[model samples]
Target chain A: MATIQHPYLLFLGDAPDQLAAKTANGVKVWRPEWCIGQFRLPGCKADLGLPDVSIEEAAAQGAKTVILGVANRGGFIPESWIVELVKALGLGMDIASGLHTKITAIPSLKDAAERNGRKLFDVRHPSRDYPVASGKPRPGKRLLTVGTDVSVGKMFTTLAIEKEMRARGLNADFRATGQTGIFIAGEGASIDAVIADFISGCVETLAPANSEDHWDLIEGQGSLYNVSYSGVTLGLIHGAQADALVMCHEIGRPHMRGLPDYPVPEIPTAMDTILHMAKMVNEDVKFVGVSLNTSNVSADEAAAFKAKTAEQTGLPVVDPLKDGVAPIVDRLLAG
Target chain B: MATIQHPYLLFLGDAPDQLAAKTANGVKVWRPEWCIGQFRLPGCKADLGLPDVSIEEAAAQGAKTVILGVANRGGFIPESWIVELVKALGLGMDIASGLHTKITAIPSLKDAAERNGRKLFDVRHPSRDYPVASGKPRPGKRLLTVGTDVSVGKMFTTLAIEKEMRARGLNADFRATGQTGIFIAGEGASIDAVIADFISGCVETLAPANSEDHWDLIEGQGSLYNVSYSGVTLGLIHGAQADALVMCHEIGRPHMRGLPDYPVPEIPTAMDTILHMAKMVNEDVKFVGVSLNTSNVSADEAAAFKAKTAEQTGLPVVDPLKDGVAPIVDRLLAG
Candidate 1:
């Protein structure tokens, strides 16, 4: 993994809407101290509520990296964005991007970084090799947020838990495993880009041995029932050796993502399958709670659903955004 | 995948023993008509029992490619071997290798191949991009050989089944998913070498829609209980959309491969877990038979073990090498 330097100058390059700059919003919300200010191109529709800073002003303010925080269609780095990136590199700042198109692959950005002696970080692609996972139990504790399907708020749930743990002065760190999470963390591998043989190994490396008192809140991917991505999910489960797992689910998903014929697994079935696989590496693995994405439901519906789920599973349930992860964190601490 | 031209000259370059040239032995055993002759340098300790021919003689004998068929220490193509590879390229023959060190990375062989307008295939690396698996059922009858552990004869069992099915005038093709299997089949991707997200997708492409009666005997990889590689195994299961599955297990395994503390999963437990995961994609998936590697046991022990296993699982059980997979094929075709 690359040591992406901060304070970051987030670049919202002509984003079509606020949703296009969600990555920027995540960074601002999670690591506000590391953010210097936002830099926007002409016709940009997103704002980070920070003062607009130019390349020169950001450099003067000691920004060490210019982050490409907005996603456009196709995840491409537009030709116009390259000019701003090149200028940032020339002004003694590294560049970090989570786009499908690598900033380092642009010749102008590449040459400028080389001449200026700065780095270019493509957070989506791993920057180092990983060994085959040994599946040995390492020190410290881990809690993984697995899901019923993709895009079910696993990352958000994980980050919320990390925040709650920190508020209580618990020793915990959020371990990122995806592109946006990688950018937010400033340094972590995107596990999906790794070779199939090394998926678990990459996760093992991402959350290595630490103090026995500490917790690594590992962000999860895919799902045990998702035919398209269950491999990634299983690898993460094995490598995490998670002592506790938090199941994430959306209230109204019709089917597994991208596979219309496959229905989302029932919660109990999903829990049984995931726990069975996780126990191969950690025999003591247990489910601490459930996190729901109840955005589609009204407040009354969300509360009713959460209560019913809690009663059914005998575990605390909450919408991480609406209710926070306090109930889940309380269960984790109790254990 | 690379269309590796055959009529191959097998290069057994200074291998220490016959086991080192097992890949060459496999190709000769499975695709004898495609092998021209064996090529050995001085000090070679292994022989494929074919006529020893020089590059010029092999090319004259209609060899389209020179296959590096021995595993040396570190899987590196030795400096001495490159000279012969370049010579073969000049003689209108392409080069194919399954070494950890890629032949195309060697400047001399790469330059030679480019100048001669020939191809250099690194079979251990995927040659093309793959889409994520859709998990939709395609038109084909597929049989997948899953395993109890890594190196438990999944590939051999699959090949044996293909041979038996072909001999019976049944429509079947062996779908390779590893380096040795790739060379035997002439064209297929090494599934473990693929990007994590594309593991199932690569398998989907390798064994695509065919005539409804045709069978693609897709070779499997690591075990579902093997913590290090269950991800690859799960991905393969989902992508196979297999109508029939053959479980391959080695007799008398004390523990899971590479993990001292993890015991090998019992056959019934393994079957239940694998079938549960497989059902996520193909609800009708069934275990047609079990293939055992009985080489470690005496003849009496092998027979008793096979009979016991058959009774335990209610499926045909056979040592793919000794028993010839006839019973398993009968079971498969009967359905």
Candidate 2:
């Protein structure tokens, strides 16, 4: 994986709403010091609260990369956005994007980058070869966030824990595995984009041997019970070799994401299956906490669900956004 | 997946030993009627016991494809063999190979095939897009052969069961997922070569819905216990959604294949884990038999091991090559 340079100029190209600029919002919230300014096309309604700067102005302010941070419908690069990207490339700013579209595949963007000797990073597509996983344990303390289904706040949980651990003066870093997280971390592969044979190997590469005292809070994807994505989930679990796992769940998920016929496994069932698989790689693996996405429930219901889940699993339970992850951090540090 | 045409000319290009031709040997043993004749280059030591014919003669005899059946050191296509392959393509025959080297990537061979309007199949590489697995149970009976470790004869066991079921006038077809199995089955994607997110989806495509009584004997890959490849194994299991499963094992003399520190799971442990995961997609999933690769043991030891395994698991036990898989087929039919 290429190490994406930062001091980023975030491009919110014609985003119709703040939600479409969620990727940009994540980067700004997580790495404020690394961001220079926001660049929005005409009719763009989203703002990052940074000064709106033109490409030349942002380049003069020492921005090294232009990040395409908006996710519009269909995840395609509009023809209107090409000229500005070409301009950024000619101005010696490399480009990075978390979009499903590969900006590097566009001829104008590709030519500009090549001509100006700049790197183009399509973070959602892996551009390097990864060796098959060796399955040898490396020296690092790692915590992974696994979920019962997709979009269950695994990323939010890990990021929250990283923040809490850092604020407490502990040695910790968030290792991203998805597009939004990649922009926040500034370096990591999209695990799902890798070839099937190399999923575990890619994870091994993402979180390699670090200082034994350091905690690498690796982001997770998919779920063991999700038939559509369980393979990716299992690969992530095995490759993570996590010493600590935090099960993430949504309080009122109707079914496994996208498969109406499949229901999400109960918290205990999900934890048991995850622990059973994670133990294959790390015998010392244990669940330190449960993180709930309570967006679908009332505050009273959320509190009740948290209390009941804590009793059922004998672990710390918290909503990362609502209650903070300090309790999970306490448990992790205690261990 | 492209349906490779039949009446194949087996290309044994200077193989160093009989084992080097093992893939070719598998095709000959399983689908003898589909093979036209063997074509050997000078200094080749491996033979399939078929009449040796030149490319022209094989084409004249109605060969539609030339199959590369040798596993040379490092799996690279030798420059010396390209001319012959090009010649065969010019003679209006498609080419297929399981080598790590893709024949279609070679300019001379690729151009010849293009000029002649013939196809080139690199069976180990997937050439199309696959949707994420839906996880919805489709109609038709499916049996999946899972194993305790890699290279423990999952493919052979499935082939044997398919053969037995067909001989009894049962509706059964062998669905291949690996390179060698693709050659035997004539068409199927290499599951390991798919994008990580698509492993299960590829399997679903390989064995789509069939008649209610028909059986798709899907070949399995990797092992849920093998640390290096468990992700592939889990993906295969969930994608299979099999109604019946046959556990394949090799007794004695082993750690997990290629991982010295890991031991293969015992029969009961292996079956339990597989059954648990398979049930995520198929609630009625079951173990119908155990297929032992008893090549490591003497006849008496093999018999003792088979008897003990059958007693322990309460499933029919057989060596697909040695005991003819009759008992396992009997159990499958009875179910």
Candidate 3:
């Protein structure tokens, strides 16, 4: 992950609220000063309070890359946005998009970027050379944080565990597999964005060969119980080939995110599902600990739920943000 | 699924004995003469008793479509096979490949096919327009047979259920997803071949709006517990929007297919996982029955295992072939 040449412009599409909450691609704003300003659709609310500028203004402000930072349902980039995207490309701005719709695949936008001698980075476009999972045990200690459902803090858990491990002077690195994780880590493939067949291969390349003493904190994606996104979840699990996993869950997500009818599986059931999934590729895989996301709950409620989860799972449980992922990191180190 | 115009030539690249097992793609031999024998590498035994012929010779024998029938690990087509494939295409024979490596994507192969006016039917190529799962309850009663792992009789169970249902005057069709199922039914896409994100969409296209009384028996691929292939499983589960599920397992199997290190999950746990996974998309989804593959066990063992599974799962159990899937079909029909 080389330093992305700076002076970026964030494209906030039709919905500015999504980016305001740090959902989807909003995490890129963590380094806000580098962003010249945001470009939103005409009449679209700029709820995030960033200066809304036109494509010409953004370019004048030294925006070198236009980052499409608001994700819509199905990841379909609006057709109207292509006109603005072309304008940005014509203005000598490279396009960086994590959407399922590849900007490079759009003929008009592609021609504009090519004429401008600018590049298009379709982050979801997978590498062609990812090798299939060999099922043989690989060297190095790896730990993946699987969640009960999406937005259950899998990335946070992995980062927290990696942070704790680094604090102890152990060799560990957080492997990002989504937009936010990639933005945070500066280098990582979006696992869910990789083509289904090559997801494991993409994952394999994310954390290349490491020494047996090195611990790669591979981030997990969608839950096994998430029917819509479980394919990515399974691919990540098999691809990571982790020696052990830390299960992550929000304290009271009764149903899948945005899918109220789909009830979240109990912590034990979720653990069993993930373990069963992991054991398919790595027989030695075990549950190292649990990371509970108690953001919506009180501190006392979080602690009570954490204790209950630990007792049920017979694993150390911690809220990665509140109490730190020390218990899980310690377990991994001890093991 | 349209009629495949095929006077077929089976391509068994490296290992000939694998196709002899009548597993995976070997069941394409269900229609023997459509196959103008098999084409194998020199010195590789064609143990299935099909005459070994060269691609040129097979083309002369009126083979219209060359079916890459034997699945290799990772579906990697040998580079040398491409030379033979191009020669086959040069002779005006359409190539029907189920491999993960798309023949149509190969530049040489594509050019040859285009020049020769021969079509490349990559059965695994998913339709680009698969809609994301809306999570709405769809009309009609659909049943998907989920297996403990790959090769655990999901297709066999599905076909048997369809047979029983049809025999009982119910309108049930076996929706095929694998090469064998396609060969048997004369139509179906290999769901595993589809890009991971579009698996559900492919499944949706496989069985469109059916009458309320109709039952579509979707042939399942891979297991929810099999980490390497669970993406396809979850995709099929959600895409089918099944009302009831039939759990399938092989008796006395100790490990995941191909992966020797990973042990097979117990039937109850496997059932729990499938049910939990299905419930995430279709809240009304239920396990109507369990179908065990008792090919390895004696009749007595099979019967005892069926009885034990019934007791363990509290569902009707049967070996779809030997015992007939009538018990399970009856349960589904009853429901």
Candidate 4:
């Protein structure tokens, strides 16, 4: 995957304030040069501290592309955002959105992009039909970071693992499965947005079959314990047919995000379930390690969390950001 | 679900001889009038004695419906079945198929059925758009038999449970999710055949809102441990919003039915995974009992297996067919 060389404007359209992290994540990771003034629903807190500028203002600042950075439920771009989008297109910025509801599906947006002779990137639409999983062994070694819950650092862990692997002189690539990863990498399918039946097939297409010395670090989605999206997770697991797995977890979460009644599952139980499920399709699948997310904890707390999780699961555990993913990378290489 | 009063001819259609059990299952359970001759692939055994006849002969025997009864890999109906299908339609018989490839998709077969004014029953097509799962409390209680692997008596156990419940004077209905159960019950969506995204939605529609005393005994599908089909299993669990569960395990099965390397997961782990996953969606879900499939085991072995499984899981275990589902029914009622 190559980086996008064109300067782009990040657009967070009428998103609820609670989604600031998601919006900020795109900016921080993708490092878009200029961001349009924040757009938010009423009562949303806008505290990210980026310079507030309108779409025209950002375009004047040399933004050649507009990337929708905030997530909306059902991925529907708001009606209000269309006007600003048109103005941006009129200002000569190409539009790229990862929403399930494609920007191309909106006639006005489609026409504006076409009239301007600019590309409209819809990352969710799969380019072609993918073959159903044959349960055959692929040529390359694949590593997937599955999580105990959504937003528990699967993507971050995957990226970190890939970085460490490459540093150690291994051929490694990060296979993106979500919007943030796609924005940073400049190519990938939003597996969740793909039609459910074809998700596994799409994942299969994402990670090209390669030789054994090559490593594909695949990002994951919803947990097996997450009912609303377990299908996506299962599909990714079976589709990638990974040789090794890294379980991801966040510290101090009492329940699944947005699911108050459902407590976060025990890490060991989650790990075992993933290992058994993966091995069911790929007989040689193994649980190589764990990746801990200690974003909100102190250094001492993070260390204790890592040690405890490692002891409990009997797998090396590390915070990718704090401790680096070298231990997990070593485990993957050994396997 | 109501009974199909029409006399249907079971079409085994060039399937290998080992699939006789699948054909015989439909006949024994659905009990269509006067058995028709078996069809076989060349060099295949035809030891299941029934009237050996062609499709035309079956139509002559007053068969008004042609039910494609044998299971095929990849759910593709063999090309050789087209000729017999054309002949059957010419005889004014309606065609019904449970295979993933809809019979209606075959232009010739569809034209024949339509021209003859006969209905084409594509049993796997979802009857209607089912609503996304709201995770709200459903009206009636539901009992779903989950399994450690596919073909482990989920449907039979569900039927047995409903039977025992009804005999004890409780309101009960069997919710079928596969072909054989659908044939017996006269109405059901094949949950496995539905597109992955809407599987949970279809299951939600199968067992509708009802009064408090009502009980919907939902038949299960592929196991959560079965990698090839875990999405279907997970979707069904969440969609059913079941209040109680029966863990089903087959005695003497060393591995998953089709995937050889995928060993049948240990019953306790499978039970816990199902419980945890279900509880994540439906907080009230409970593991009520165990259903053991002892068809291939000796009487003594079956008894010992039942006892050991019951002791291991700390739940009452019974062979629903031989010993009756009374114990499981009692637990469901108590819950």
lDDT of 4 at B19: 60
lDDT of 2 by residue, A272-300 (tens): 98999899989999999999999999999
lDDT of 1 by residue, A1-335 (tens): 76788899999989989998998888998889998999998999999898899999999999999988778777667888888888898889999988878877888888999999999988888888999999888999999999899999999999999999999999999999988888777778888888999999999999999999999999999997888887888889988999999999998888888999999887878999899898888889899999999988888888888888888889999888888999999999899
lDDT values for all models: 0.90, 0.90, 0.75, 0.75
Taking the tens digit of each residue's C-alpha lDDT, what string does model 3 give over B152-238? Answer: 888778877776777788888888888778766657887776666667777877877788998888999887766566667777887
Residues A158-255, model 4: lDDT tens digits: 88787688778889988888877876666777776555445566777888789879988899988877766677788889888899899999988988
Per-candidate TM equals: 0.98, 0.98, 0.73, 0.69
- Return the candidate ranking by lDDT, descending: 2, 1, 3, 4
Quality of model 1 by C-alpha lDDT: 0.90
Superposition error at A43 for model 3 (Å):
8.1
After superposing the true interface residues, what Cα RMSD does each candidate give?
0.7, 0.9, 2.4, 3.1
Per residue, candidate 2 scores C-alpha lDDT tens digits across B1-335 of 78989999999999988999999999999989999889898899998999999999999999999999788677678877898899999999999998888887888988898999999999989979998998888999999999999999999999999989999999999999998899999999889888888888988999998899999999999988886777788888988889999999998847888778778889999899999999989899899999998988899999998888989999999888878898998888888
lDDT for residue B160 in candidate 3, whole number 0-100: 73
Please give me the DockQ of candidate 4 compared with the native complex.
0.22
What is the C-alpha lDDT profile of model 4 across B212-294, one tens digit per residue? 99999899987777666667788888878889999998989987866666678888988877887787667778988998889
lDDT of 1 by residue, B1-335 (tens): 66889899999988888998999998999889999899888888898899899999998999998888679777677788888888999999988898777888889988999999999999988878999998888998999989889999999999999989999898999999998999999899989989999888988999999998999999999998898998999999989999999999999888998998899888888999899888887888899999999888899999998888889999999888877899999888888
